[model samples]
Target chain A: MYGWIWRRLPGNAWVRAVISLVLILAVVYVLFQYVFPWAEPLLPFGDVTVDGASAGAGAGREEGAAR
Target chain B: MPVRLVIRTFSELCITVGAVIVLFVVYVLYWTGVKAADASDGEIHRLQDQWSRGRIELPAPGATASAAPPDATQEPQKSQAPQATRGAPTAPTTRSAPAASAGTEPARRPARSTAPAARPPAYRDGKPFAVMYVPRFGRAWDWPVLEGTGVNTLKKGLGHYPGTAALGGRGNFAVAGHRRTYGDPFKDVPLLRPGDAVVLTDGASWFTYRVDRRAYRTVPTDIGVIDPVPEKSGFRVPGRYLTLTTCEPEWGSSHRLIVWARLEATRPVTDGKPPALRS
Candidate 1:
């Protein structure tokens, strides 16, 4: 998959490397700013309240309560 | 050539998945803390600015009117006053910030009634109304206490349970914070010792609560720990109390750790920092 992506690039190797770096950073930026925050509430690691169901089983119940 | 391509793609997919997982862990453990710190600091500054401008955000007066008993509803009721001063003249003199001590003192002292004061007006959810400091956490460790315990609220800093007692009021003023990420506001919750002070200010008065005991371990479902008279906390009657809850195991939320405190003293902000904070 990565080889195919590399071969389809429009630039020489150096330019492709720079473009890849920028693309990688943009992906990470999106992950941290949007994806992770949205997904964190779905995970059990951040749970703190006493009213919700325990982590792992029925995790969605806790997420709903938290909302 | 097709088989080679398939193998290469499979290897790249595996490597990409592994890298993403590691990055997610870094986001949870480190980046979140950085973002929370910035958010919490901004909240503290905003609260202080509001206080300096003489704007104290109280819960809507009528919202809790029916719930609060007649005696408890009074704004300056003795029930909500700080119980007593527990310090000697020779204060610890540990680390006092000059910037913090510059405010003018309130002209009148808090009344000494012993009744448990009613809960204060309901603060708006996600709005910061007070600042909390634990000397044990470090002289510089302080966080803005926002008014709800929801996930997004806790990310800003310590969150005050909505139905609990207000700061310096009778009943339990329970707070929850993250033990790992989101600035790890309660990371040292387990280290709190009996008599350690958990000080808080709502712009007008400084409330000093002394740790009643070391951390009490319990499951997250044990909501009784924040009761006005938490059974396991050694409190036999209703009184002013504080409960700090955080996830246990340091890095996971499998269980919970609780630290109970009793109101020790209430000082007007103009009087300077509270005694517990001096050390």
Candidate 2:
């Protein structure tokens, strides 16, 4: 997937390297601000309510509870 | 030459996948903390600004007389207010508590004779209502205490369990926070011992609660840990209490670490910072 994007870049190796860094940062920003949050609820860990309603308790996922 | 091209592309693909996985881990462990720190700090500053402007919202005066749980007494009075006004990012929406007991008003109405204050404060779902300080954590450990324990609510800071007592009120005032991430507000819950003070302020008064026991471990299913008189918390009578819960195993959520506390004292902000915080 990334190889295709790299091959299509209209620049020399040095210029492409800088563009690649910027592209990587943008992807990271999107993943952190939107994609991961939307995906977190679908996972079964990070629940702290002690209400017994949370599913999939054995995954051993770390972090705080959200449910 | 064709074989060489295929090998180069395959190697690049493998490296890209590996990088993505590593980035996800960083998101979970590091980036979340940074975001939570920013959110919680903003909440704290906003609360302080309100307090400075004399916009502190104390509990309703009628709440002072009747010592029943908040769900039974407070919900009925505000039942007319639409509980469905949720999802607005900034509005202070009413709580969406389980209204099964909205009826059956307590007969002790005469005890609650105090007139409603100029403006009765409604519990704003998913919004911050107080700031909590744990001296055991550090001289600077503080987090905003928001209402509701929903996934999004706890992301900002500690979440107050709905249906529990108001801060410094008569029943159990329970709050939950993440143990490992989202600023890890309760990261040192296990370190709390008897006599440690968990001080909280609602911009009006300082409430200091004294830890009553070492950290108690229980399953997430055990809801009794936050009861008016929590099981195994060593209290036999109904009284002002505080329950702080976080996930167990330091990293996983299979169980919970509980720290039970009792209200030690309360003082208005006019008196200055509580003694617990001076140290």
Candidate 3:
């Protein structure tokens, strides 16, 4: 993905380098400001608790009570 | 020849340094967000599946229908006919007929009781127990609220402070999310104005809270903002409160930004939609 972006830039080595940096920063800014937050609900990264315990345990307890 | 060789080596060094800097930037700003988003997406799917499969145990009165023990089949009967004699005081036929009819009436009311018993589940650290919605941020401004404020949970979405009050409860329900990285869930929180609705749902009911105050600069050690009655929130007595905290300056965490909201209304999920989401 990044290679495609880099190859699409229009510049010599020095100019390309500067443009690439700016482009990269702009992409990062947009991701932080809009894209990532919008996609947060779809991620699976935060299922574990900080106490070294998994949420599944509480879920299991609820299940047991429920059953 | 020697001078030419040195010149060539100097240019190579510059190229290598520049490449290293560019790679570092990609790693920090791009790669991390990608990984965090992927993780958050997985959790969301799992949560939705659990809800769909009836794994989430509704609290109390609602619990009996889906959670009754095998040996306690009589419990539902008891709830259905509260006036029925335990030891057959009256004619079984005459009493049970009316009790059966009365039982269905209370069953309908349990759906409403669901709200008061809809205490946020005691989820494991990073698991989502509720989803937050801020119409002030637009219709797409919703994120799953994980159970605890651990590093892992914050990376996925908003993390609920462990010691704070439960969502829509009679105390402060404090949460924290990233301001810049790890999906930047609170990136636009600063734009929220007073009276803006900050709503959340736990699959049972919608809890709408109205933003009443915003604090732009607060020290990391300031716990008063998450207090039951948040300082500077303009509230003197205890009430349902929602406190949202994120890093300040949009790029740094030298200080914190706090937004305080008061619970305004709660509607059951079966009620179709809350006013905050009507538009």
Candidate 4:
């Protein structure tokens, strides 16, 4: 797949390399600023701590305290 | 170009875009936290400077003694006045005589009653109002509580929900922060057990809240957790409540993690550190 793109380039190696780099950066910038934030609500990718840990850790202290 | 060559080129472009998307996720989840932490730290330092400059004040420890004589008409209600003074000094008074005189009148009223009356420091959208210390998170865990939850405000620190009760006021004082990105101010929120103290100081007094319960799951649209009488907060009446909320599951905003704490004590900053903060 990559070989085909390299062959289709209008210029030599350096020009193709520059074009590739620019395209990659543009793609990254658009995704970072627009696409990702828009899709964030639909993604399930932010939790760093394990689930149920707070409940388990807080249970004993909660019971010990009188409401 | 040949059909096979065109197909190959398109596939290659797809692969590159796919890789870029993956990198974008990393930038959002990790890089933003790094940048937000730097911004939040800068805000925290600025607020600390403001506090140190005497812009915020707790009433002078003995101001009430002199205040009693001037407001003699309030003598019947004087007993409860000292308690209000215990938490706030009734705006910064430059003159000792005037401060004492002013203190007596407000002291006669309830702290919550006078809090809203005093002109609170004009909090700009991204400005810090108070500094929150969650000892349960760490000895060094502190975040500047900013005025609003706008995107710019969250980048700096925890954002105070607009239209909610002011800190230490009569209604629910609520704040929202990022759970994972944006410095992860509430990253360890789940570790807060019942009875854990969440202390906030706006340079005048320390308002300590005792965590009553932790609501592990609430839908993203659940605004009830921030209500004056928050649903599932274990409170039945209107009172001073502090609601700390963050995105749940550490990585996603599929739900919210809500922690409810009731105002347990309000002490003048002059009284030294509250016991919950005794290191």
* Model 1, position A26: C-alpha lDDT score: 98
Stretches off by above 4 angstroms in model 1 are: A54-67, B59-111, B114-116
Per-residue alpha-carbon lDDT of candidate 1 for residues A1-67, written as tens digits (9 for 90 to 100): 8777888887899999988899899999998999888877676666676654533222234323432
- Alpha-carbon lDDT, every model: 0.72, 0.69, 0.60, 0.64
Residues A10-64 of candidate 4: C-alpha lDDT, one tens digit per residue: 7888999998889668967787788766665344433211122221122233222
Best by DockQ: 1
True contacts kept of 4: 0.13
Worst ten-residue run, lDDT, model 1 chain B? Answer: B86-95
**Could you give candidate 4's per-residue lDDT for residues B1-279 as a string of tens digits?**
689788877888898778877787787778777777788788878876665444542332223333233233223234235434444433222212222333333222223434442222356666887889999999988889987665556667887766667787777888877787767788888888999999887755667898997655777655666777876777998878888877777876567788889888765543445678876
Q: lDDT tens digits, residues B1-279, model 1?
A: 989988888999999989988988999889999999999999999987776554556532112212223332122233222212211111111122232233333222332345336555668878998899999999889999998777778889888877777887877888888888888888888899999999888765677889999999898788788777899999998788899988888877778899999887765553567767765
TM-score for each predicted model, relative to the true structure: 0.81, 0.76, 0.63, 0.67
Against the true structure, candidate 3 reaches a TM-score of 0.63
* Residue B70, candidate 4: alpha-carbon lDDT: 29
Better of 1 and 3 by DockQ: 1
| Off by more than 4 A, model 2 | A1-3, A41-45, A55-67, B1-9, B60-121
On residues B1-279, what C-alpha lDDT tens digit does candidate 3 reach at each position? 879777777887787668655754564467667766776777666655555443553332122233222332223354334223221111111112333434222221111223343354466666787778888777866688887675556767788877667777767888877776666678788788888989887654567888986654675556577777876778898778888877666765456778888878664443335667788
Residue B189, candidate 1: Cα error in Å is 1.0
lDDT of 2: 0.69
After superposition, the stretches of candidate 4 with alpha carbons farther than 4 Å from their true spots are A1-67, B56-122
